[model samples]
Target: MRYPENWVNTKPGLDQVVKKLSSLTSLEFKLTDALIGDALILFEHKFRNIGDILINAFTIVTKRDILSICLRELLNPERTFNHYDLFEFVINVIDKPEEKILFQLEEYAIENPMMDVFQDNNGLIPQACTILKYPSIMYEYMLVKFGTKSRVTRYLMKEIITAHIGKAKLIKFYPSLASSVLMDFRWQELDYIFNTYCMAGVPFEPEFLPLVKTCPSDTVIKCLFDGYLSRLFGFKVEFTLSRVDQLPIFNIIPFTHREHNASSEANKEKVEWLNAINCNQYEPITDTFRRHLEKFRSRLRLNLI
Candidate 1:
């Protein structure tokens, strides 16, 4: 309710008032549209790093559209915040999922080259875990990122599953669940993805077969099989048969398993020769090459050069 002296007359006084009030995180700044707009403009012109204040203010704002405005400013190409700072701002503030805001975030991430670094295990994986912790955003977030047909969405879904299961096998998937922060929340999200979303008429993805087979629930598998996976059974068989012929390693496995089979003398010699050069059975070839190169360089006096 209070205004600085000259607040009605000068921009400087408004700036001072906005700056002082936005800084106090403990104060519940009941930000109106005009004040919020003024504060953002000040941030653009004079205080580029006051993102924390804006983030906090947006989080508590009664108007949902205000959050969208904050996102628009943050995603502005000319905005001063770096990718890491932008990421923190998004994670800290985005408690609700507005479809438009989700689209903006996904689009910016797809288009901005700087955003790539955060998609890795140390980055988006953990950050996503944090995002899913919010009960409000979890379902919408999953539906947007994992329930889509987009190639990027598929990759993100795979990454999250891989991070949780460590290996992609559904059989080993349940055992891999170790205790960690917000993991129960993550499981709930995964349960939705695997159960409700996947079962709903989303066309079966071939890559999903591996992940689907990992589920131990008979009902889950039965629903998936009757609904989506039954057709893939033949495709799976044919694909595996095709790959076996294409990959020589498959042949080697059968050969190794054959009864009375032993390494042929020629194969043993070849193995020894490979090991010799590989340095598992002798001094590394790099050492010999280094010595030879040193001798030759000495003869040519190239070492001095």
Candidate 2:
């Protein structure tokens, strides 16, 4: 980005942008440094006596564009500062070794229908609440609802609620908190997906009718509980990458709710995610996540065998 001859009077804000990037790998650090350095060399030739401090500021369109490209290339590491990087750390489950046991019940054994995935005693929330640098909404929710030392098993069930009710609709039931703390973080992308899609008036499969019918204030659950008729009956899948957005390719199905229809009204949607997968905003897939995902899949296969 070139500064006009008069901009020498303006402060150099670009350096702050570069300084903020904490490259995890040597390659990333070198690339980031090299790019900034090269940009400065060109800046010197292009602008006289601007001083060596370069940082990104929203003041100029060109500089903004350059900063955009530069930070994006850095994978735009989380500015967690003293906060936990949820996306980076959330998937840590892949690193954990899976424990398994094969057991057969006796003919007269009583049925214990509880599924383990539904249990939160060993879930991400408990561990996250303790270590996260900043107290987040989820952490706060955990503390108030489950307490610091222990966790409740039904945490994800609330996910279905938030996904359906959204922060906006929560104003009716939850009111103050909905208008406050519950406002920002996505409980599920339901708020966005419904607002965007409903506003757009997207169509759904006929079988999806049952989901619509069963949808409740805490509803985003109907779609998954559909009878195996959906399995027996062929249906094209609609992919949802997150609550608010869909994957580019065909997705399985998306969840939506009409109310609580709130979230990231920052004019952001799940589709805008660039920092989560890898740090590369340019690539559609995150290389790092793909590696972990493959390992998870391998572990799953071994368990199946």
Candidate 3:
């Protein structure tokens, strides 16, 4: 026999079941066990009605065994229902006037912040971002329950941003999150962050430059040069393979040289040496070195005041 296509949307029927389940104060354990068995049977039939009934009843009247059974069933990957429906049911419970149910949902989101409720190829990241999309959902349920700027929220944000960037196509969907992730100080992820920032056309901040300066990766440097500083700031910096014959030989100099001529050609050679090897090569040099370099000839400009 074919099951009813709208079996999952039978809220009225579920509400009746919830009422029956709630009235079992004397025989609560027996009723709950029976409900659990019925819920499992309904779930196997792909009818979420019994599950909804059990969840609503458990939320109103707390029973550890029943709640655990419902949660285990909710999290089961083999369940026929999709995450959107499950999320809707949870949200409905959260929105109810009853504080106990809302509190339970809040506690659940905190404990299982990265729950595998969704079937997206991206896993929990999308569901996390969806929760974040509704800041009211975050502010009302998550923030109060988990506290502001909690580790769970931060972790979810990190995962979402990483997963979003991993799929090049999805980056455009979350431009603001992408930009925020780029501002992180962790040196290793800088290039990915920098490239995402450039791709999103997000405004550059002066704070970012100092962070990028700390990274030693050549790829990070090249990204800074080609992706951001060169085009965005309109600088003419380019990386090219220097010929073996053109490479300069190193010459040692005394630590202290007397009669240092700040305006002499000898000073230009010293500036060149510093620019060639100094970590701050990106910084502009004085007149003589500036004259020979096409890019630095035009004094470097700061995009942010």
Candidate 4:
């Protein structure tokens, strides 16, 4: 709060101004000219000189223009910058953040001799890859920066594989990536991985036996059974037979059935196939599916309408 006699003529006291601005709520920090003027003055004075203080201000301020200004200033190549928090803050706040900023952060991380940032699980580049939509250039750059055989590259690939898995959901599969990650790491969400591969038409493999043994949710079991059938028959097929306990196969037996000539034969064959496969090693649910089907068929025969 101390003002020199010729404070106006000397370096402007903008640090306190920025500090106060940082504490104000988004709603309170209206983009009025007075505020922008003060921010611009702060930008000019404190940007290169005060690193820690301005970085803190950048973290708290949410306004795009101020953030933009701070980010531009931080990216100055010659500046001895090492604030990962500030780097992450800018990228997270801005939509589709500049690749250059991420590059700069990576450079700083690499230059630090004490810590192997790339190898560190807590490194920001992997997280940054998620935000930047995993550009191939960035991925390749990282691979070369940290040799492919290195633990760091494996970690980066893990991030890439995880991102692909999340995006795959049920319909898509990244075969190479899936194999690479699954063969090495034991993911906690085996059910999700199983369901994704099953629904994506990946044939049953012995490796999946452990997942089947885990006895995942009934819906996942249905996916497993359906996948096995598809692999066996060389054609994609879904069991739309009946719902039992909300499971696709059989749950509550429908009271009456309206018979259709075309689908009756197909349905019968599916049921027959389902029964035949009940004892197969690949069929993890034993006779649960067949038992439900039989129960439903019996209910239909009784004409309980």
Q: Pick the candidate with the highest TM-score.
A: 1
Q: TM-score of each candidate?
A: 0.29, 0.22, 0.27, 0.21
Q: Judging by lDDT against the true structure, name the best candidate.
A: 4
**Cα error, candidate 2, residue 189 (Å):** 6.1
Global Cα lDDT for candidate 3: 0.37
After TM-score superposition, what is the CA distance of residue 147 in candidate 3 from its true location, in Å?
18
lDDT of each candidate versus the true structure: 0.38, 0.29, 0.37, 0.39
Error of 1 at 276 (Å): 40
Write down the lDDT that model 2 would get: 0.29
Residue-wise C-alpha lDDT for candidate 3, range 28-48, written one tens digit per residue? 555454455455545543433
RMSD (Å) of each candidate, 1 decimal: 22.4, 21.2, 21.0, 20.2
With candidate 4 superimposed using the best TM-score fit, by how many Å does residue 272's alpha carbon deviate from the native?
Answer: 22
What lDDT, from 0 to 1, does candidate 4 have?
Answer: 0.39
lDDT comparison, 1 vs 4, better candidate: 4
Q: Which prediction has more favorable TM-score, 1 or 4?
A: 1
| Candidate 3 Cα misplacement greater than 4 A, ranges | 1-52, 58-81, 95-154, 160-301
Better-scoring candidate (lDDT), 1 or 2: 1
Q: Which 10-residue window in model 4 sums to the lowest lDDT?
A: 246-255
Write one digit per residue (lDDT tens) for candidate 4, span 269-291: 45665554343535444254545
Q: Which lDDT tens digits does candidate 1 get at residues 107-133?
A: 655222312232221322223422222
